[model samples]
Target: MNLNLRHAIIQNVASNTKEELEDTIIDAIRSQEEKMLPGLGVLFEVIWQNANEDEKEEMLSNLKDGLQKQ
Candidate 1:
């Protein structure tokens, strides 16, 4: 088993449109299943990698707020 999960995840979503991607993310979150975490993590990694400083700061702020609510 030589699976590259990150690459696999990326590949799986590579052809999705914005709406489709949004649906996938939303469904994954709503499902509340542990298996979806890795896919969400990979999506977050992609978002973080592509985001600018301000976006990153916003994401961090949102994350902090989300954590506080938990």
Candidate 2:
């Protein structure tokens, strides 16, 4: 992460009201994920290493169920 971006996040989140704080945390988590995904083959490799066969299938099933509700 860039130093300026870190500083910006700290400043904004620190100043957040109760309602804004949830959004601030969600945005920070999303930003970190955006920086890691697709190109980060190591992330998939880790997922594969840790997730068992049944766990993967269950995750896929839950994803499909959630999407259908939407």
lDDT of each: 0.94, 0.60
RMSD of model 2 against the true structure: 9.3
For all the candidates, what are their Cα RMSDs to the real structure?
A: 2.0, 9.3
Which whole-number lDDT from 0 to 100 does residue 52 have in model 1?
A: 100
Worst 10 residues of 2 by lDDT: 36-45
Tens-digit per-residue lDDT, 2-62, candidate 1: 2598899999999999999999999999999999999999999999999999999999999
TM-scores for the candidates = 0.92, 0.35
Model 1 lowest lDDT segment of ten: 1-10
The regions of model 2 sitting more than 4 angstroms off are 1-45
